[model samples]
Target: MFNLFKDESQSVNSFFLFMQSLANRNLVAEALKVSEAKYRSLLENMGLGVIYLSNAGTVISANQVAGQIMGLPLNNMVGRALTETCSRIVKEDGSVLAHEQHPAMLALRTGKPVENVVMGLFNHAQQDHTWVMSSSVPEFLPGEREPHQVFMTLTDITRRKRVEEESSLASVIVNNTGEGIVVTDQDNKIISVNPAFTILTGFSRQEVLGKRAHCFQSPKNAIKIDEALRNSRKNGNSWQGEIWHRRKNSDDFPCWTTINQVKDATGRTTHHVYVVMDITHLKKDQNRLGFLAYHDPLTKLPNRMLLKDRINHALQNARREGSQVAVLFLDLDRFKIINDTYGHAVGDGLLKEVATRIKNLVRKEDTVSRYAGDEFIVFMEDVSDTKSPATLARKLIETFNIPVEVKGHTLQVTTSVGISLFPRDGDDSDSLIKNADAAMYRAKKEGRNNFQYYRPELTTQAFEKMAVETELRQSIDKRELVLYYQPRVCLKTGNIAGIETLVHWQHPVMGLIPPARFIPVAQESGFILALGEWMVEAACRQMRCWLDERVPVNKIVVNVSAFQLLRSDFLATVERILREHELSPHCLELEINESSLMDNAEHIIKALNGLADAGMDLTIADFGKGYFSLINLKRIPAKKLKIDRSFVSEMLCNSNYEAVIRSVIALGNSLNLQVIAQGIESEAQKDKLIEMGCNLGKGDFYFPPALPDAKNLTKLMS
Candidate 1:
C-alpha cells in the first residue's frame, strides 16, 4: 500500500509540468502571428516596388506597387513559377539574360547571395520592359549546409534610369554645338562651360571654373551684368543682340549673345545662362563688301557711284559755304586704238600709270574716279575760282605728256579733259556730269590732249535740237525704231521673270541712240504719245511671236512716259494695239515712273486702276526716288514696286541705303506687292538683295539690254 501511494504522486507532478509547457507554446505562436501581420502591412504600404521569388523561381508574394510596376496582378503570380520562357529577361546592357545569370537562379545554384543586380524584365500588361535593381539572398533552415530557397527582392528603377539616359544625351549635345554655352551661379561665378566656350574664349574649364564670369576681359558695357539681370527679371525678357566681348588673346570681337536668367518659383534669381555666337566674320564680310561697293577693284579709286555721292556731298558743302566746286570729266584719247594694238594687258598697265599720275596731281580734298571703260572723272571741292580749275586742267593735260612705260612697252598716252563748274555750268551732279561729258567730246573734236570749259549753248543749240526732233518724229516708223529687251530674272535661280522693253533709234550716223539721249526731246515735243503707241504695238507683235514659238517669257514690260499717261486716249491705244495682235492684256505689264504718280494722281490712279482691273500688271518705277504720301501710294493700283538702281548698288556698303532698301521691301511685303530690285551688278549684290527679300532683278550682270534671238530666248527661259 505504501509503494502505490509514491507512484501516484510522481504522476501528478509530471502532468503539472506538461500543462505549463503547453501554455508557453501558445504565447510564442501568438507573438509570431502578430509580427508577421506587421511585416506584411509595412511592405504593402511602402513606396518601394517589392517582389519575392523562391529558389525555384516561383513568385511567392508581391506588394501592390510591384504588381503595378510589373504590369501583372500579384494574385496571379502567387502560385506560379517565373520560368525563363514566362518573360523576356535581359541584362543591364540589353543583352538577353540566360537562366543561370538571373539573380534568383545564381543565388540558389551557388548557395550564396546576389545583391543589387540591374535587370530588365518584360511587363505582361504594359507590354514593355520593366527595369529593376534586384537582390537574391539564399536562406538556410536551421543547420542545413545549402540553401533550399532564395529570397529574391526587386525594386523598380525604370524612371531613374530614363532620366539618366536623357541627361547623358543632353550632355553630348551641349558639348558639340557651335555656339557657346555658359552656366553661372547667382553671384555670376562661372560654374560650367561647354567645349565651344573654351574654343571661343581660349579659356579651359580648369582655368575659369569658380571664377567670376568675364574676369579676364572687360566689355564696353556696364561693369556689372547684374543690372542687366535685374532689368530682365523686371521686364520678363532676355537681354539679346550684339555686344562686344574680348578674347583671351586681348582681341575684341562682336558676338550675338542672349543673357537668360533662371529664377525659382518665388522669382528669386538663382542662375544665368549665356548663349553666345561670334559674329566677327560677319562684320568683316560687311566691311569688305562696303569697300568693294564704293571703290573700283582695278584702279583702287572711287567708282562712278562713289563719285556721284562725293559730288552730292561737295555740292551741299559748296552751297552752305559759298564755294565753287569744279568737275572735270576725262577721256583717254585713242585708248581703244592702243588697247587693240598692244593687247589689253599693256593697255591696262598704261591706264594704271595714268591713273596714279592723275590721282597724285589732285588736291587732298578732290576726288578721282574710274567712271567707265577708259574714262576717268575728277571733282574738286572748295575751289577758289574758275581759274583754279582751268590751271588744274592745264596741269592734268601736261602731266600725261610724258610717255608712260608699261609692261616693257613704250607707250604715249594722252587725255581729253572737260571742266564744268558747280552752280555755274550746272547745278546738280547729273547735269554737271552730262555737260562735262559733252565738253570732253568737244575737246576730242577740237584736238586730242587739250582741256575745254563747259558751254551750255554748245550742248544742243535750238536749231540742232529742232533738227533732232524732226528726225525723231520721222523715225517713229517701223524701220527706224527698234525694241530692245532686258529680262528681270530671279536673283536666286537666274530664271527670267519678264521682258522689259526699251526703245532704241537705229540712227544711220549715231549707230544706236539710247532713249536717254532722245526721250527728253520726245517728251517735250508731245511726240511720246505717238512713240508710246508704236512701242506698245511692236511689243505686242513680239509677244505674239514668242507665244507662237512657245517661248516661256510670261509678260512684256513696256515703258510708259508721263506724256502717254497724261493723254486721255492712252488706255484705248494700248487696248487697240493688243486687239490688233490678238494678245492678252495680262501678258503686257506697263511701267510708269514713280514721279508720274504725283502729276495728276487722281487721273493717273483712275487710268491705272482701269488697266489693273483689265488684268494688266502696273509697276511703279524708281519707287524710292519719288516723294508721295502713303495715301497716294495706296490709292494707285499697282502690282509691283521697282526699287531704284541707286539703292541696290550701295545697299551692301551703306547702312543708310540698306535701311532704305529694307524699309521698301518691308513696305512692299505689307502691301502685298512684288518688290523688284534694279542693277543687280555683282553676285554679292544679287545675294544681298535676295537675302533682303527682293527676288526679281534686272541688270547687265545677267545680260545687257538687247534684242534676243528666238533660240537664246528659249534657252534663257528654259
Candidate 2:
C-alpha cells in the first residue's frame, strides 16, 4: 500500500510540469503573431502597394494598398504572380523585361531597393494601368544562399508626371509670347510676371510681386479698373477690354487686357491670369484714320460729312438744353476774281488761310466745316442769348475786311455770311443748310460783304422753286411747253430785224405758265439740254416756215442755258437741228447769259469757237447784271450784248442805271457789236434806250409771246 501512493505522487508532479511548458509555448506564439500583425499594419498604411512573392514567382502575401492600387483584394491576390497575366509583363522593344533588368526582379535578385522604375500593370477587368516607382527586396533564411521570399513596393505617379509636363508647356508659352503675361492670386495681388510685362509697364518681376494689380492704374481713369475687376470676379468669367494704365515713369498709356480665373481640381479658384497688349500707338493710328475719314485734307477742318454729324449732335444738345443753335454759311464774294487773276493755286491758298482765320474766330465748342468750294459752315450751339449770333456774325464780317496775302499778291476778299437758327428758321440739317445757303445768296444779291438771317418768306420761295423744278422734268413729256417768238425790230426802218424765240408752258390744267415759271427749273434739273434742243429746233422750223411764206425775218434768236452751252456736243446738236429744218446757221442766233461765260471762261471760249466756226452768231443776254472780265469777253465770239430788264426799267428815273446802260451801249458800239435791250416795257424806257444808241429792242411792250399761227404772227410783227 506504501509503494502505490509514491507512484501516484510522481505522476501528478510530471503532469503539472507538462502543463507549465505548454503554457510558455502558447505565450511565445501569441507574442510573435502580435508583432507580425503590427509590421503588416505599418506596411499597409504606407499608401504604397506591397506584394510578397515566393522564390518560384508565386504570390505569397499582399497588403491592402497593393490590392487597392491594382484594383484587387489582398486575400484574392495572394498566391498569384503578376507574370501569370502575359499582358501584365513589361517589355522593352518586343521582348519581356529580363528578370535581372526588371525593377522588382532586380531588387529581388540583388537584394537591394529599386528606386524609381516605371512599369505597366494589367487586370482582366480593368485593362492596362501605369505605375511610376517599384521596389523588391529578398527575404531569406538566416544563413541560406538562396532567397525563399521577395517583398515588392509599388507607387502610382502617372498623374504627377502629366502635371509636370503641362507645367513645362505653360512655362514655355509664357516666356516666348509677344504679349505681356501676369499671374495674380484671387485677391488681385501679383504672383509672377513675364518679360513683356517689364517692357510694357517698366516694372520688374520682383517689384510687382505681391503688389495689387491696380498699383499701375492710370490717374486719369483709375475708377474703371476696380469696376472691371468686380464685374469679372462676380460673373466667374473672363474680362477682355481696353484700359488706361500708367508706366513706371508715370506716363499714361492704353493697353488691352484679358483676365481669367484659374481653378483647382476641387473647382476652387486659385489665381487670376492677365494677358496684356500695349495699344497706344494702335489707338493713335485709329484716331488718325477716323479723322481723315470725316475731315477735309486741304483745309484740315470738318468736311460736309463731319459737319452733318456735328450738326446732328449739336441739335440734340440744344434741344435737351432748351436752347437755340445757329448755322452760319459763308461764301466768298470776290473769290472768283482772285481765282481768275492769280490762278487756282493762289485761290486755294487763300481759301486755306481764310479757313484758319475763321476757325480762330469761333469758340472751341463751335464746329467749323468746309461746306463746299469757297464756302464754309459754322455751327454755333447754345445761341439762345439775344443778338449774340448777329454780333458774332458782324464780327466775322469785319474780320474779313483785311486783305489776304497769297503767293506774293495782296488780294482783297469779302465773305457773305447767312444765318439760320434751330426751331425758328429750320428744324433739320437739310432745311437749315438750305435756308442758310439761300440767305447767303441773298446777301450776295444785296451787294455782298454782309450777314443776314434767313426769312420765312425765303423758305416759302425755296419750296416754290422746288415745285417749279419738279414740274419742269415732266413738262416736256406732258406736252406742257411751247415756243413763242417776238420780232426784234430795227429802230431806223421799223422793220422786223429778227425774231427772238422764247419758251413758255401751256400747262394742261394750270393754264399758261410763263417762261419764268419753268426756266429756273430747267436750269436746276440739268434738263436745260433737252429744252434747249427743242427751242433750237422749233425756232429753226418756224424760221423756215416764215421763209416758205415769204415773210422777211432775217434771223431767229433762241435762248440757250449755260448747261447746254457747256456741252461739247452742243454745236453738233445745233447743226443737226439746222439740217433737219433746212435752215441756215446765219439765220439763227444763240442768246447766252453773261453769268455763264464768266463762270466757265475756258470751256465757254472753246464752245464759242466751235459755234463761230459753224457760222452761228452769239449774243450775250443780261450783260450788265454780271461782272464782266473785259479780257475774257474779247475772246468770246458774241455779235451783240442784250441789256437786261433791270437796267432799262429805271433808266429814266435813275441816272446811275442810265449811265450804266449808255456805257454798255457805247462799249458794244466800240466793239463792233449790236446792243439789244430786252424787257422794254414802257415807251419811255424804249425811247431812252434808243437815244442811248441801242440797236434793237424786244419785250412785252412790243409784243407778248405769240402762238405759231399766221394771225398771231401778224400781231407779233405789228
- Taking all chains together, each candidate's TM-score versus the true structure is 0.47, 0.55
| Global fold similarity of model 2 (TM-score) | 0.55
* RMSD each, Å: 22.8, 14.5
Cα lDDT of model 1 overall? 0.83
Clash tally for model 2:
0
Alpha carbon lDDT of each predicted model: 0.83, 0.81
Tens-place lDDT digits, model 2, residues 347-380: 8999899999998899998999988888999999
Please provide, for model 1 over 1-718, each residue's C-alpha lDDT reduced to its tens digit, 9 standing for 90 to 100: 7789889988898899898899998899998899989988988887766666766677778788777777777787776777622477888778998777887888888888999999888888879998888888888889988787777667888998889878988999899999988899988899999999899988888888998766644467543365656666766757876667777887777887778988899987898888889998999998978998998877889998999999998889889888899889999875754664457898888878878999999998889999987889999998888899889889999998888888887777788999899899888999999888878867776866898888977578544777889999999663889998888988888888899989999998778999989987786566887898889989999999888888888899998976666566678888888898998888999999897675445656787888888789999889898896778889978989999999989988899999998898999999998999988788898888888998689998886787867455456766
Name the best candidate (by TM-score). 2
lDDT of 2: 0.81
**What stretches of model 1 exceed 4 Å from their correct place?**
1-158, 169-184, 189-214, 217-227, 241-257, 274-283, 297-299, 303-305, 331-355, 372-375, 387-418, 440-718
Task: Pick out the ten consecutive residues of candidate 2 with the lowest summed lDDT.
Answer: 85-94
